[model samples]
Target chain A: MHNSSRRGFMGKAFGAVAGVGAVGSLVAMKKTWDPLPSVKAAGFTTLDMSIYPEGKLITEKWRGKPIFILRKTKEMIDSQTESQATRDIVVAGIHYMIAIGLCTHLGCIPAYIPAEKEFHCACHGGQFDWSGQVTKTPPPRGLDIPPFKIEGNKMILGEVGPEFQAMKDSGVTL
Target chain B: MAHFTKATSVKDWLNQRLAVEKIEKVMASEYWIPKNINFLWAMGMILAITFALLLVSGIFLLMYYNPDVNLAFDSVNYTIMREVDFGWLWRHVHGVAASVVFLVIYIHMFTGIYYGSYKKGREMIWLSGMLLFVTFSAEAFSGYMLPWGQMSYWAGMVITNIFSLGGLHMDGLVEWIRGDYVPAQAFLTRFFMLHVFLLPLAIMGLIGLHFAALRIPHVNNQDGEEIDFDAEAKKYLDGDKAGSKVMRFANDFMSKDMMVVGIYLIFFFYLVFYNYGFAMDPVNFDPANGLKTPTHIYPEWYFLWSYEILRPFSINIGLMAFGFAQVIFMLLPWLDRSPNAVPASRRGKFKIWFWLLLVDMIVLTAMGKLPPQGIFSTIGLVAALGFIALWIALPFITMNEKKV
Candidate 1:
């Protein structure tokens, strides 16, 4: 009985050690799949807000997604509700609506219609108004506002700032 | 006239070491198949043939196909299709086989359900087959990415985005899965590796398991009659072959399987030559553009039923329904509470359930392809709910079934 019990304990102990080694190896393998440090370093993009002209929507690539920066003309700003005003980012006293260009419905890049001051996703007919709020069905929510910080006349994207955090906390952006 | 004297010395030499004769007898010659089975029983062999075609054609494509995001499109369209000799033919073969293989699998799957092949003794066969289906789906999704087309990029984007867990903000996990914030070079290479190497290995392993599972309980027959396989084989061996209800799996059953395979290949290659356009999406002709998405995006036809389930609801609810659709088929053996392993036609309520499920899936597939507009959206919602309702109703309806 003593010999059999000792053998059982040894077998279990060896099995446990082997299991730990296997788990450690799996963790190491999984770590290799994460975004590399260089990819993470290239995550942030800084753009001079003043360089973009008013009323014209320009698309720039940041972290491989289209970033839509529309310097809101007076007419565009006048069309928003009190709630919509809060979604706009003011940098150097300039009102601008910045959002990740992909449609909220299925991630298609929505085209900005300068005439109507609205974004239209041709893929599914999902429409977003000047403030990046959905003006059509199918898109469950508004165009997602990217994490950004305003400093002087420059906007840095992919960085969490107080303003972005406030919008997130208010459930305005995801 | 003795067997050993007639056999070649090389056969004897190898058989002495390997027990080749015993293995052949065990796996093939002495293995029994019911005589009541139909041409639908040939689907397993047809699926194996299709897989071999995919492997061969994929290897040819891989020789010229570049995995880089910058070069992959041109490498496929310009280099292979335009430059390599008969490359278009090989591509058409691969494309048609990939699409047609799913058709065969569905027929195989539905035939199993119709015959109650997943009854108590054959759960492993069904489970392993389901595993193969899931793996093939992954392989197809990964292979779809290799073309580096508009549909490829956007499909990758939409699918990876699902990992966010219906608004839980699991972007970290999604990004890790894509190897970047979006589908890029690393994403393409990793998916290529999975499509070519990892997934195929898993599929081959699962196929082995599926066949091995079939060996013990043997295949289910059409009438669901339980035959005495050993006694029938004994009858055949005793020169009472005309009285036996079972036949050898080797020369006898294999000859029938080959006849069905020959007819299937004619139909398959007909599509490869004349109707291959159905398999290669026109939207995918445009190179992958991260900045642009096609006007309409959808998965291949095989995945349409489940994809439709993911639409027409709130994000979280739709995802739940989609998850349910994906896993429900695998649980059919458990959900079906019927006592008899008989055909659906004889199973009373299950007969209606079977046909209704098939029609609902076809409706779902059609709705999935159309733009989710006013009427289409309503129909899609109804059909999606109906699918869930049918599966939910399965156990209650089946539990009271009278055994045949």
Candidate 2:
């Protein structure tokens, strides 16, 4: 190859190498973007709902996240369970929800925006309706419905409820 | 066109519907940049490169960062620094690139001012750039709070309290924003969202408008001479050719921009690795303590000049002046009444006042570091007045000057 062509080829080669290397290194260095796992394992974790009463939300680290265990108000439950969209997550009669707190988009937990009647992700503007369906996306789907059970008005969460399971077997899908 | 419409390929099918080829040619390939433009034109592209770096590194930092007040400091400074793979690299790069972005923006803004790039039909470009700077500050301020450090906490407090100067209570709004009566989890989390998502999106839209406005008139050279594109284009095939006056954006200007960007990355990395302290304040090493304020609270260095202008006078009057001065500066396009597109070298008072205002800004920046006492206070007061006076006097000076 002539000197000029060889130099041009070498320049292009170096540029391409440097460009790919820079981006590759940056991405390789990034930690996994998954939301921190909830530490409270998927089993029967007992919580007395009496103390939490209606309208209080309690948080526990299940699977390494502070997944919300809400003693939801009767009104909130009435409104939510009335719709089929929330059937999988809402407790059968007790007005409780073991809802996933972490945003599906970037894993940052969202705070309940009271005025908006929705959970708004702080890290990104992903909004979930009261029924947990994503009203605004960038979160591809709604907040995850963590499976739970209620016994004697006390919540046994992160496990399938026997009564709920029987109902599901009868083809009653929420 | 047939190649893009082939039935077997999704990429081709979508590209065909989107008209991707035509868009690329119109936006990039066929766009013409002024050929003789110097290195300073590279400032806009450098600002762009630095912003890209900030976005990438910031995303990586966000992966491991927790925005809870009790955990934010430890999560950012300890666990992310010590546990996460290449956490230190991402953290340092993001922090350093923030300062670099501001530096590039300042240079770009002042370069336009010096060359009168904002004059005439490019008013919208200047306005968008000004608004971009405002959004940039909001973006930076919100990010600063994410670490929950001493300066971040105190600065947030001071700036929020500045709203009280109008005498109406601001505590309610402040508490509403913080999600608490104090800087806490809510504040950190909300700021993280704004910094990472909202501001980035807003600034990109503004930059798109800036670029759109820029392409209309093309870039202004050092002389800031008007180009009658109809006359210039008639010299060659209007659609296909770029003359000596205007270079093609695809290869000629893009190659040069890439070369400058490569060189700038070397310096950027040097600061990220070796002189990283310039990007951070020593006070930020301590976690935020609301019970105690730092002895001397100051803004980041990029804001020092404007902060200095607001300092050393009666709090009420100085604050008013600061707001007024910013508005005046942004309105420079209409305010500067010079008939000449290219300013004359020896335009008497106008030329002298231009350099004078530049010197005043440097002096004010220096004063921002000193205690507002003795000579510095007097200098600050004078600098504030003189800076405003220069702008107020510019139109009169321009009208009196002899045309080149």
Best by lDDT: 1
Q: What is the lDDT of residue A37 in candidate 1?
A: 91
- What RMSD does each model have against the real structure? 2.8, 18.9
Model 1 CA deviation exceeding 4 Å by range: A1-3, A113-127, A135-140, B1-8
* Per-residue lDDT over B195-286 for candidate 2, one digit per residue giving the tens place of the 0 to 100 score: 98999999999999989888787788777767765455444335544544666677778899888888999999999999989878888889
TM-score of model number 1: 0.95
Model 2, residue B249: displacement in angstroms? Answer: 0.7
In angstroms, the error of model 2 at B107 is: 0.7
Residue lDDT tens for model 1, B75-162: 9999989999999988999999999999999999999999999986899999999999999999999999999999999999988888
Docking quality level of the chain pair in candidate 2: incorrect
Writing each residue's lDDT as its tens digit, candidate 1 over A135-156 gives: 8855778989999987889889
